[model samples]
Target: MARWSNWSGRQRSKPVAVQFVRSESDAAAIVRTANSAGRTVRVAGAGHSHSPLVVTDGVIIDTSGLAGVISTDAQQRRAWMWAGTRIHALGRALHDAGLGLVNQGDIDRQAIGGAIATGTHGTGASLRNLSAAVVGARIVLASGDVIECDRNRYPELLEVARLNLGSIGIVTRLQLELRDAYRLREQAWQAAFEDIAPQLESLARATRHFEFFWYPQTDMAHAKAIDETNAEPVYPLAAEGERCAYSYEVLPNDRPHLHTEMEYSVPAAHGLSCLDAIRTLIRRDFPDVRWPVEYRTLAADDVWLSTAYQRDTVTISVHQDIAEDETPYFRACEEIFLNYDGRPHWGKVNYLERETLAKIHPRWQDWWQARERIDPRGTFLNDYLRRIRPR
Candidate 1:
């Protein structure tokens, strides 16, 4: 049997066939043929998502073949590319065209399609996730029909498609709103947990981009803040110096290690309180766990399924080495996430259920109706989607 696994190796699949698709017609054909043969279909991106969204025993379509920049609207500051384009590749291409993505998460190895589908983001109180840059998309539906949607045409579809969790349909290409390329300067520092924890909100609000990783073993927080700059580019190898470079260069961290992670977004107003609770929980029981707890922020967005939907958000991420049993550590933090009205990142580890999801998202039913209309029989639905997706 042909097998597939994610970046962290936490989820795996033994698909009957792993098909690499190049064109929209080919993608549509595969979906049609799979449904006719009664085999569920799921498309594979960079295979970085931690969730079991793509695990299936049927056919898995690889989007790597369908990768490249299609065109750019330099005048409108917009660009669209085959959804399979990797974030790092896209950044280089856009930078060549004098454009850059507005924000990015720590890892840049993910395909742009997967990044947008999962609401990937970076740290900034005013910056929205990569999904928010989506101005439109070309989707190949479960029925083998292709359609386009944006602010002008099929506006409702754009709303749900912004962060569809790969359940709506196969997005062949995405149109993104770009910004004139910009540079950023970074300053790294370390301090005791007491020093940063109390001033977390002020620090986040003051910096253009800010985040900290609290190392549980030493009770020290390694903090980094980056701000827009016109200064000469300076690249440093040490933690105490200042580094200045393009936004893409300074924003993402290449986390090369294999690890299982869980992240949740809570209300911005309650960020410190939530962090305090998590800090207490870690110190009280799981102090021996050697990984750090991550803290970041995201501005509000209108995407119906977005964690920051209708409110500013503070995202907290916890990680464990791949070899460790993450169950006990993750479950305990999950209780705190749930208590603070936290919404889990779709691409990460989460235990959210249907009833809980509906209660949290005001437009939950609307998103489901839109998805069902696009793929009524769930030809694209997986076990994970079925569990959390509203009926």
Candidate 2:
């Protein structure tokens, strides 16, 4: 047996075998062999997801070997990369080809496929989640068949594959709709919570990207904003301050694997009140806990299972240093989020079940139908994902 644990040292799994694949055919063969023996198969990327999405007792396929920029189309503003390519690597690779991602989250360690599966996003009023950026994918189905999907080819499948949560298939290559190469100027500032809370929406609207970090014991927060610029790059990028560099270089922060996180997206209108409620809960009960809360925004997207599906949203994340118990704090925060109609991030620490999950996503059944079309035999499903469906 092979042992695997996620980035946070949580969500461990002991699979019967672990195989690394360098090509689409290899992944398909592994899935086919496992299915023949009635064993479920799960693909593991950088293993950065905090959820148990990758936990399985069956065979584990490591896709890191199938990584790199494959091609670029400057005129169409699109690019294709192997599924296992890391976001940071893609950022640099894409920039060299006169293209860049529409947006990127602060952390860049996740595999492109994993990040898309989890509906990850950067902070911006106009930007949508990474799932929304996906224009096409080459997937290996449970039956050992390959499928290519895009807006014109199997368009309905493309919509489901956008945010399939790894239930659809093993994505070998991803086609991203991008932009002509660009640079960004990143600036950091501090502000009191009250002042910043009320202005989050306005700030998000005013900037290309905006987000903040708030600690439980403090009334103030560390805030940041990034916007495109034609100015010269800044040198000596400190731990924090200012920098002007390629969009990829400036967009991703150097995030150490310090804390495990819990994130949820609520309606944009409810962002401030939810923050206020969390602050009150933390102060009145968890005063000793000092991890920062992250606040960001996502434009509405149509990806069925996306946390921000069909509605503009505010994504708020709470974290605790990995050394401590994050349950009580995370669970309490979840309660408040649910009260405000928040949807949990698929890759983060969340206690949501199918009942609650189904209620929030209007296209719940449609997403399942898409999954059924891809893997009706449940060959790609792990016990964790099985819970995503109603009994």
Per-candidate local distance difference test:
0.88, 0.89
lDDT of 2 by residue, 1-391 (tens): 7998888887799999989999999988888899899999888889988889989999888989989999999999999899999888898789888999999888888999999988989999899999998998999999989999999999988998888778878899999999998988888999888778777777889999998998777788899998999988776654454888888888887777567899999999999899989999999989998888989999999998899998999999998888999999999999999999999999999998888889998998888887887788899999988877755
Report the Cα lDDT for residue 38, model 2.
Answer: 98
Off by over 4 Å in 2: 236-238
Task: Give model 1's clash tally.
Answer: 0
Cα lDDT tens digits, model 1, 1-391, are: 9999999888999998999989999999998999899888888899999889899888888998888888987779999899988888887788888998888988789999988988989989999998888999999888889999999999988988899888777899999999989998888899998988888888899998899998988989999899999987675532322667887788777688899899999999988788889889999989888999999999999888888999999999999999998888899999999999999888899777899889878788999998888888988888888787775
lDDT of model 1, residue 309: 91
lDDT of 1: 0.88
